[model samples]
Target: MIHLFLGGARSGKSSLAEALCHRWPGQVVYVATARSHPSMAERIELHRRRRPQSWHCVEEPLALARLLAEAGEDQLLLIDCLTLWLTNQMMAGACLDQATEGLIGALSACRAEVVLVSTEVGQGLIPDDPMSRAFVVAAGELHQGIARVADRVSFCQAGHPIPVKGERP
Candidate 1:
């Protein structure tokens, strides 16, 4: 089953995703999508501290679909945010069209339970710059497409999750 967790900044989406990962019976891979930077060191450490040592961690900023294919059916993969992945792909000049479509295909073909974390960034004010606007629009498009294919979709706000589709877990 594919689960999509959507939320704003500091809205407990990661915590909820981790809880779900902990409940999974088989191997769980925490696929962190954030790129390591000095400014993000503390944040990354906090997340690392939250996860159990038994769970494997893979830091992949892009090429998530390829990683998903590598994970196979026996393991459950929790991708802790598509927002950063998209940004990295965009910055790296990857073919967004092919990348997003490939992701959907890879996800549909996967037998493993996949949990995707994403931030809902379209609800805020319109950005004045083209790059910022492009990011928002791209993110919105990606979320909608992923949500359609996801078995479960939930919105998180203030540490609470409200199911938008499928069964609550």
Candidate 2:
């Protein structure tokens, strides 16, 4: 099963994803994509502290498809956020289309249940700069694409989750 969870910053999307992982009877892999910059070091530490010690952590800023391909059928993979991954790719000057296609293809072929958490960036006002605007547009499109392929989609608001498409607990 593929689940897509979307919310704004500090909306408890990650917490929700972690909670959902408990339902799966298999090893849980936390695939984090955030890079540890000076400004985000504290944020990184806080996230690490909150996650379960038993869950395996994989920090892959890109090439998620390759990681997904290596996952065991009995494992459950939770990708913390796609926004950082996209940012990493953009900063690295990687081919966005190819990378996204690869990720989608891998998700479709993977046997293990996958859960993706991402920020909803489309609700805000359009950016003034061209690059920022482009990033927002791309991120919005990517979120929509993933949601389309996801078996379930949920929106998180102020620490509460409302199922957009699929069953809720």
Candidate 3:
């Protein structure tokens, strides 16, 4: 089964995703997409502290589709933040459409149950900067594509989740 969690930053999206992971009967694998940076050390540490020690953590800055394709049947994966993953690929000069297609294809073939978290960035004002505008466009497209395939979808606001496309958790 595929589930998607969407929210603004610090809106308890990760916390809700982790809770769902804990409920899964299979082994939980957290596929972290953020790259470590000096400025993000504190935020990263917070996430580290939030996750249970029993869960296996994989820090993957790119090649998410490849990783998904390799998932074992006994695994349940929580891909924390697709926006960051998209950003990582975009900054690396990858073609956005091709990358997104590869990801959707890989996800369709994945054996494990999966849950994804992503920021809902397109709801806000348009950015003046070109790169930021591009990011929002990419994010919007990615979210829509995933939502089409997702078994469940929830939108978070003020730490509360309102079901969008399926049964509420």
Candidate 4:
């Protein structure tokens, strides 16, 4: 099953995803897409501390499709956030269309249950800059695409989750 969680910053989407993963019976693998930077050190540490040591962690900013395709049926995959992956792809000038297509295909073929976390960045004011506007549009479109393929979707606000599709988990 593909489960998607969307929310603004600090809205507890990651926490909700983690909680679900903890309920899974098999191994849990955390696929982290965030690039390490000094400014993000504390935030990263907090997440690291929160997750159980038994769960394996893989830091892959790109090539998520490959990882997903390789996962076994005995595992549950939790991708903490897609926004950072998108940002990395944009910064590297990767072909977004191809990447998104590959991701969708991989998700379709994946054997393990997957949980995806992403920021809902399109609800705020319109950005004055072209790049920011483009990012917002891309993120909104990405969310829509994922939602279409996902078995379950939830929106988090103020640390509360509201089910958008499927039953509340």
For all candidates, the clash counts are: 0, 0, 0, 0
Candidate 1 vs candidate 2: the TM-score winner is: 1
Q: List the residue pairs that clash in candidate 2.
A: none
Q: Residue by residue across 3-113, what tens digits does model 2's lDDT show?
A: 989999999898898899977777999999998799889878887898888989999998789998988889999998899998888899987777787788888889889
lDDT at 63, model 3: 89
Question: What tens-digit string does per-residue lDDT give for candidate 3 at 73-132?
Answer: 999999988998999999999999888888888888899999999999999999999999
Candidate 3: residue pairs that collide: none
Assess every candidate by TM-score.
0.97, 0.96, 0.97, 0.97
Runs with alpha carbons beyond 4 Å of true place in candidate 4: none
Q: Of the pair 2 and 4, which is ahead by lDDT?
A: 4
Supply candidate 1's per-residue lDDT for 132: 92
Candidate 3 achieves a global lDDT of 0.91
Weakest 10 consecutive residues of candidate 3 by summed lDDT = 17-26
After superposing candidate 1 on the true structure, give the runs of residues whose Cα lies further than 4 Å from its correct spot.
Answer: none
Best by lDDT: 4
| Model 1, position 95: C-alpha lDDT score | 73
Query: Can you list the residue pairs that collide in candidate 4?
Result: none
